[model samples]
Target: MSAEVDRGNLRSRIGMGDVLVVMVGRVGEAALVTGECEGWNIARTVGRVSLAEAAPVNPEWLATWLNSSYARQWCLSRAKATTLQVTLNLAALRELPVPVPPLPQAREFLRLMAVMEEKAQVDADIVRTVPAVADAWFRAETAGGWLPTSRFGELVRIGGGSRMRPHPEGAQPGPAGYAGPSVPVVAPADILQSELAHLARTGTEQEAAADVPLCPPGSLLVAVREDGVRVVVNDVAVALGRGVLVLEPESEDDRYWLLHAIRCHAADLASTAQGAGGREISHRAFAAAAVPWPPVDVRARFAEVAGRLHRRARTAAEEVGTLAALREVLLDEFLAGGSRTSRGSSPAHGPSVRGEGVQESLFGMR
Candidate 1:
């Protein structure tokens, strides 16, 4: 598919200003084509729309409406469920409704949207970049294997989730008589999908967390997938599911150190996995794997240095949720014609980061 032979021959090729919609798999995902993808072509599963010369809609506005909850629900309802994935037929896609406001109103809405999207993208980049910096530091400081090493189990407490009360099929059951605030239920799927080093949210929440022993923030959550091991430092209190393993540090000083240490040993831990599909992490094998055990002073120093970066990452991660909720509210108002008189506002300030400067500060040799 990456071959150049298909470049000029394909009719599916998209140019700037074309709107794209995912017609299959993750149905309803939409985007406006920019110069970055000038000559690129979409697969059979993707639908491209080239507007007529006199059409009254802007590509960005149309793309935004297609990505909204209203449009997503509409597409999902009509998409055909297949064994491997859902498929959206061309007829259904053609029937998708788009709301068009006057050019002035559309431009104002786009102005506000661009601001929020820019802020969210910066935070997303931070979530991905900070961990790489920390991992680089971990590799550099322990490069020559100067520190003494020991079995991973000896360095931290290893445990799994407790058994929950049985519930009827298709229903979620909480601890009896416990009706209170909800906490995220940390599942293997959540661990697999987490892009940030720290998890601030999950798909499922339960009031039963009040009765379950919540894993405090800062504990490491680990899961094994067919590809390899996945790990993240949880930011909020979360109740563990049956498939995840928790690595609780013995002291605050060891928290970040243990995090990077386990990450470094991901491949080694992954080799221990065994299951029907070779996807389960073997607890016995993982505990027995060897890892570098640095001295107390070394760990404390690394923790002190890396802790700041991790905290910033966590802050940005939390802000993403708030921004997302606000975006949805504004999107709904625009859809309902409730924001006709509203003028677009500038983006709110987000957590400050000096992009490459932060990396240099973290990776600068000691």
Candidate 2:
């Protein structure tokens, strides 16, 4: 949505509770607007179309239904080919059949969705608050000290990792003749904020040592993309993937402090990123970025405090993931069984559907 365009002649205005369908490119994507977007101008070139709910159909319920497999299949069947992408016009979308369950059943589904949404907001709040608190603490701790500001290159060695080709064959021994323990590989996606130990792939120790450098514990891993600069402290030794840069601090104990410092300057790093396809901070540029270098005692004390806060944030994030998974399962079950019948009647049972049992297990009720 653009605010620069004149809104006087625009007939269709999106408002709070409106559902938007991405009709082109990533064809079936849908979203519900939780806030007002009345004055902004929407471009049809982006392939977005707004939906307003009529009586007996809740906007939230309709948005959820549009995201389900049934709606996706329907949209795919009706899509027309464009020069470079598939698209569905508003007329075609109108022809897609929607299940109209009883009003009471629709209300129940909305109620459940509200609960999940509330929990998601709480999780987001926790994830967002910890970093802000840490940033503030860092500023306060560095305010009084005669802390020298040093380029990251002066305090750490920065290096990019290798792109290892995937092997076609199943699990075997080391790279050809070498034999040693399997080395876990860490990619940019595996590097979470303030915590890094996620291993998505594994390779032979020989391959890791020979082809790609292994980042040791206390190394800072950074993702150099425009999405945002993500920084994490590695808790264990692992082989690095191509998308991440490993920052090895001269003083191993300075790892946590360095991670927090980089995080504080994340916005600055992102602004300095340069590239055509995606904004990226080059290895040399990232290494030359300035950071606050406080006294050893101050760093150690801050590290201890920051570590505790980061641990709590990690736990909260994990809980959010679990809750999100539970919400997905509930949505699947609710849509499958609850949509088949009216309010009072029992939903038709099928071999693949175990809605009642799953709900009972989840809520401890039959």
Root-mean-square deviation per candidate: 10.4, 9.8
Clashes of 1: 0
lDDT of 2 at 76: 71
lDDT of each: 0.74, 0.62
Q: After superposition, how far is residue 21 of candidate 2 from its true place, in Å?
A: 3.3
TM-score for all models, in order of appearance: 0.77, 0.65
**How well is each residue in 1-366 modelled by candidate 2, as lDDT tens digits?**
334344443544455665667777555667776666644444563323343333345567667767755567677778887655677776666655555666787788779878877887787788778867887888887776568888888888888766542332222244566656656666555564333222323332334435445788777778756656877766668776666788888764487778778777777876545667443458888778888887788888897888787777777777777876666566556656745334333324232211111110000000
Instruction: In candidate 2, list every pair of residues with a backbone clash.
Output: none
* Top candidate when judged by TM-score against the true structure: 1
**Model 2 worst lDDT window (10 residues):** 357-366
For model 1, residues 149-267, the per-residue Cα lDDT tens digits are 88868878887775442221122556677667777788777788888878877766767535577898888889887667889988799888877888888887787887888777677
In candidate 1, which residue ranges exceed 4 Å CA deviation? 2-12, 23-26, 41-45, 76-90, 161-171, 174-182, 206-214, 332-366
